[model samples]
Target: MQNNITIRGAREHNLKNISLDLPRNKLIVFTGLSGSGKSSLAFDTIFAEGQRRYVESLSAYARQFLGQMDKPDVDEIEGLSPAISIDQKAHSHNPRSTVATITEIYDYLRVLYARIGEPFSPISGKPVRKMTVDQIVDAVLKRTIELHSDPKEIKKRKGANHNEIFVMAPAIVGRKGEYHQLLQDFYHDGFLEARVDGKIVSLRDRIPLKRYQQHTIELLVDRVPLGWPIEQNKGLQQRLTEAVELALERGNDVVRVILDDGSEMLMSTRFTCPEDGFTFPEIEPRLFSFNSPYGACPECNGLGTVDLFSDDPCEACKGARLRTEALHVFINNRNIVDVTAMNIQTSLDFLSDLTLKASDAKIAEPILREILSRLTFLVDVGLHYLTLDRKAGSMSGGEAQRIRLASQIGSRLVGALYVLDEPTIGLHQRDNARLVETLESLRDLGNTIIVVEHDEDTIAAADYLVDIGPGAGKHGGEVIATGPMPKVLENKESSTCAHIRGDKQIPYPKKRREESKTFLE
Candidate 1:
């Protein structure tokens, strides 16, 4: 009949007969100094007990391999839901786990892009100059050279044949090198002008290009011949088939004599080769190469950005700029040379002071802003001034920790508990407010947040606060206070009471911001 979750005789770690009642579905923060058994009570005790009980509930066969959690020293607990924990461990891993990849938003976006994107051909459009009407008419009459390789041997079933000739043309023709060369030499210099129906054209006079379409640019022939051979020269097969059917103007079968090139052409409606029993497959347009202009953007390969050599480092860092393994112990994400690159000196000196509208370097203002914006995400998450290309492997514990946090900060999940650890450890006083805002927003989403924190800023934002330390180690573990923010601070016996009520210096405001109040007239 207790009002909420009854945790009676929870002797987990420093918890001494901790008969506590935790309200369901509320933000409850546990606070105390380091080693005050905050993690022991939350992690080693309640979470451990929950896991043990859940696993125990499963069949013996299921529990055999899954292994239940080792029992925590706890008597009883009620009204416990499943738990989710996110610890502060820097996963300096492969870029395979980037912000886009982790949140899965990139995958979703890819589906949207591929489904609705403009499916332009990978090839560029080349130029086709305006040809005079006479010029185009002349071009149509020029060399009607066509060649087809012999059909494969297996296509000899003699089934009704459906041979057709097709020319592959560009979807959009423009002035490219190949098309220009076609007009040069061949338009006038070659024997085409004479063969093109006596329609002579000079490069000088302006003739309308409309005449080009008046004559056929390309033609197709389809007819069947009875005496097709079973086998022949592989290259000469199709030509012979076309010539035979073209030359025979009787019985809907036409055959033509071979051209001097030792090949037959497939033109005119009448044509079938000797052995005429095979059907051919249709050919479709193909992408050259997605990576090459063949199929993708030459600049970004459809990825939208190219990697600059500078952005990718030398092989030493594996292009990471940061060495793969830090041989010596560095205090944080910074090593000796990182000292130079991390231009912003301290937590207080962070970029927030740098105006989005101001700059003082050789780089242009826009460029500086771009650089700072990306690097600032790292810093705002306590990763200031680090280059965008900094390899993940060399990131410090806190730097990597916060970087992972950044990837998830934009999650669309509205009501999922985001249990955070000491989120303010590496952050300076200025960053505490940002951290506080992040937690408060998560709490506002109806999630039951439970933070094991030591930061004063994080502690103050909680809907309900629990202090589990009156001393350290064995001397600690008792619930010193559990109540609303103000009431917890008012508790005479709470260890955190003095920390909040105690006089502490607050930082000077960056700028005294006061909005003008509108008065109702």
Candidate 2:
């Protein structure tokens, strides 16, 4: 394997038979005046060749779907690797695309929350618990025993030897519209009767429920009497289990058992609050994903903001992009939406202090590590102030470029040629050092980095420098100098060296402008 990228007779664009050897696994900068063919050489010639070669290696059928590139006018090249370009292109314009979505941090967050997040009641603010089949059955039996054991209650109910119990599955509850299709489903599922709006009616009886009015309906599974010697009745327990299971499968994880005395008991096979009858949907990755129906806010459809004449925060979810139920679920006293809304630095600090149970720790360790690493990458690239919910389209060119750079760093791919265009275009002087360090970190990972930039700080930090011009446009394109930083900085023929060696300088203003009195007005 060659240790250098040898390019001979490259005449792409304005490049005039430019030939050079770029050392592999090093930070190389291409510096020149604007429109002086720096991009033409780094991106068009070298990176383009690498991409074209990779695409050509695929099958003809596969190539039809991919964009084809014309071969560069280079005579010969060696030691080229697969190339990736991180430019100033925005990732997406869709409202659904956020910083977390684009970098895939949200996906990992979804999985972590689903696995260990504790659900609380939206109404009562109490921790919800899921009841197993045995727990549900035990509760029912205990209630029956307690009622029969009360001598005063038993005497008041004269000749009431039979305890009437209605075993029912919730078909629909508090939803608008006449559910004709749902009624058909209930009848087809072997239900003979239904309790519609608190009225027991036969399935054959056509009850016209108002289409626009909210209603509650339940399928009558069975009607049994809780007489003496209830333990001997095995058939009653079997029927109870079947009804509860059907309700859990068909309903939103709840079943209602109405007693003769007008009291009711709610049973659930999911995390629920018995007091408020609040139940959560099954825990899955999609439960935390705003893009999914299970978690998306109904008002804004997971876009977080609403378009009401102008863009505004959604009233229903208040820009969280999740339903009230989802907001109730917490991990370490913070919900998923709250966690995603935190800025990168705050999120890192929050995760550092997070504690989980021993069992939860085992499941969350690997996922948490991946999330922290991606967050660290964002912080390293000077994006610590941005939250996960910030839209991708709202980002500036430099922020978008750095985001792509951070993603590449997370990939940790080796033996690749990375081409970047002005990654420090809008960065502050203080932040430039962090960006430079990030680029050096990529180089240390056994990959070659070639940047097309005019930043003096970037050029000064390069391991190898390629100055492509003595001037811009018609007067440029030929390589004036190519070597290590010290050698390039000392080249008398190179115009780039003139500025670096203090021979030329951009003049500063003699006097700074003062703020006008009317500026605030």
Candidate 3:
């Protein structure tokens, strides 16, 4: 492969017929007066050709959607690669677009939560789980075996006359109602017996109850012998399956087993609290997405505000932008909202100190790695003060460009051409070196970086310098000097070289204006 990009007879815009050779995998800077054909050479001719070539390589169907790029007026060029341009343009104006979405950190977070997040019941304050029919059957069979083999259980049950366990559904819990109609409905549904307020009673009998008193009702589904090997008996297995299904349906996904010794065990076929019977939907990646209808808060519509122009938080989701269920599903005692609410530095600290269960860690390893890498890159680009949930439209042009730059670095792509325009425009002097260092790191990863900048720190950090201009616009289409900074500095004809050598300086004005007392705040 060629180690340089060779251009011949490139004429676009104000650029005169020019030819140049630019080094590959090196940090290159184009410096000149405003409108001096620097952008014409770096963007119009070079980057344009790269984009055109890439679009051309795609299928015809793909080309139509992307539109077409007009080829640059270059005689010939060689050794071009895929090009990515980062300029000082607002990244997005949509209120829905956020920093986390642009960097794809939130996508990984959704997957992480879906895979390992545990749902805790809002009503009972206990962990919930969903089990398959086969899982419930097998668990019950295993539990029976464990009990039969235990000497303590055997001794405790020696005096018990009954060897049968009851599978019951908690139909009603602590509700104030006479339930006369409810009992009639249950009788019509073929239920024979129910334990009312801890006392077993026949549903067929007219049992009167006080209307104002709180009552608990348990509907009996089926009974299994304690010593029966249900795992080996097909009839017993089928009966148990039907019983569990009936109990789950009657109890809103919950079932209870009363052992012969009077011990009770609770199980659920869905993510529901056994005590309160509050159920949650299946866990999926979409469930954590605030942009999707399935996961977004119903009242706020995932906007976090009822009014578009308002700063007040939504009354329902309370600014979380996710449904109640999504907020309740947590990992390491924090939900997705909690993590995204933190600034980059705080997020880094939180994730660094996070501890996960062994099983959860195994599933979350890759996702955590990606999220941490992107967050670290954002911090590296001097965005440690920004929150992941901050609206992208609210950021300054320089901040948006740096964010895109950080996302590009996090991508870790190699063998590409990156064109950046004035990346250090609005950055503080203290952060300039870190930006330069980030660009250098990108170059070290085998990418070619071409930056059109006038920042002294950026220019001093360049590996190759191209100065295009005798002047701006019409007078400046030609490359005045192209080489290492030291060699380019030797060229006295170049204005940038003259300035760099201290031959030209912007002197302070000889006259000063008086301060005015009147001012607009």
Candidate 2, residue 73: Cα displacement in angstroms equals: 4.2
Writing each residue's lDDT as its tens digit, candidate 3 over 1-521 gives 89999999989999899999999999999999999998888888899999999999999999999998999999998999999999876488877788898888899989988998889987777898677777777776766666666646464443232667788898887668899998888889998988899877899899898999888898988776654554487776777788989998898777877766665667777675544545676577888888887789998888899777887999999999899889989888899999999999998888877788888888888888999988887887789999999998999998899888878987899999999999998788988998899999999999999999999899999999999998999999998999998899999889988888999998999989988989999
Off by over 4 Å in 1: 1-3, 50-67, 90-95, 116-395, 399-418, 503-521
Q: Record all residue pairs in model 3 with backbone atoms less than 3 Å apart, i.e. clashing.
A: none
**In model 3, what is the error at residue 370, expressed in angstroms?**
1.8
What RMSD does each model have against the real structure? 21.3, 8.2, 13.2
* Local distance difference test values of all predictions, in order: 0.46, 0.82, 0.86
- Highest-TM-score candidate: 2
Sort the candidates on lDDT, descending order.
3, 2, 1
Residue-level error in angstroms, candidate 1, position 309? 19
If ranked by TM-score, best first, what sequence of candidates would result? Answer: 2, 3, 1
Q: Model 1: which ten-residue window has the lowest total lDDT? A: 277-286
| Per-model TM values vs. the true structure | 0.47, 0.76, 0.74
Per-prediction count of colliding residue pairs?
31, 0, 0
Model 2 Cα lDDT, one tens digit per residue, 1-521: 89999999998888889889999999999998888889989988999999999899999999999978899999998999999988886467777878887777888888888888899998999999888876676667666666667636743333232466777778776567888888877788788888899888888767788988888898877776665676656876777667667766766676777665545677777786756666676677877777777678989878777863447889898888888878888899999878888998999899877898999999999999888988987887789999988888899888888877877887789989999999998787888888999899999999999999888889989999999987777778899998889888788988778988989888999999997777553
TM-score of 3: 0.74
Query: Candidate 3, overall lDDT?
Result: 0.86
